[model samples]
Target: MADPTPAEVQSYIEAGLPCQSLSVEGDGRHFFATIVSAEFEGLTRIKRHQRVYAALGERMREQIHALSMKTLTPAEHGATQ
Candidate 1:
């Protein structure tokens, strides 16, 4: 009945991707997350995003309606402006 704040989403994502930088936006129902993690190094973009979704667990289906994610490796993030 209440919107999950951006900080809340950021916290969840951070827990999933330690040592990473994250930017998350959510309307409590839909969320957009941008994450940079070294853990994503060898993983495909789909797999990397799946990992973040997994971190959200049932919330993804039950509470969260949609998640638009952009996951990048640390190096990739650093390369970007």
Candidate 2:
């Protein structure tokens, strides 16, 4: 199977997770995403990653391989900006 594009990855996450803002950049095999969501509030880093993985679901195992993410709550994201 052909590797998925960054846009495709972005959509995959969006389809499953509710994000305040999200962006993805990748070269098929690996991806980096900055995801901001209210759902991340009070969650630990690992839990935040788990949530994103849950959002990706089967695709995380099937299509995308390596994903490096900056998961943030709206407040955290805003502070970073």
Give the TM-score of each candidate: 0.87, 0.96
lDDT of each: 0.81, 0.95
Range of the 10 consecutive residues with the lowest summed lDDT in candidate 2 = 72-81
Model 2, residue 80: distance off in Å is 1.1
Model 2 lDDT tens row, 1-81: 889999999999999999999999999989999999999989999999999999999888899989999999999888887
Candidate 2 overall lDDT versus native: 0.95
Which residue pairs overlap in candidate 2's backbone? none
Cα lDDT of model 1 by residue, 1-81, tens digit = 565777887887777667468898878777888888888999998899888988888777766777898999989999996
In model 1, which runs have C-alpha deviations exceeding 4 angstroms?
none
Candidate 2: TM-score?
0.96
Clashing pairs in 1: none
Model 1 per-residue lDDT at 78: 90
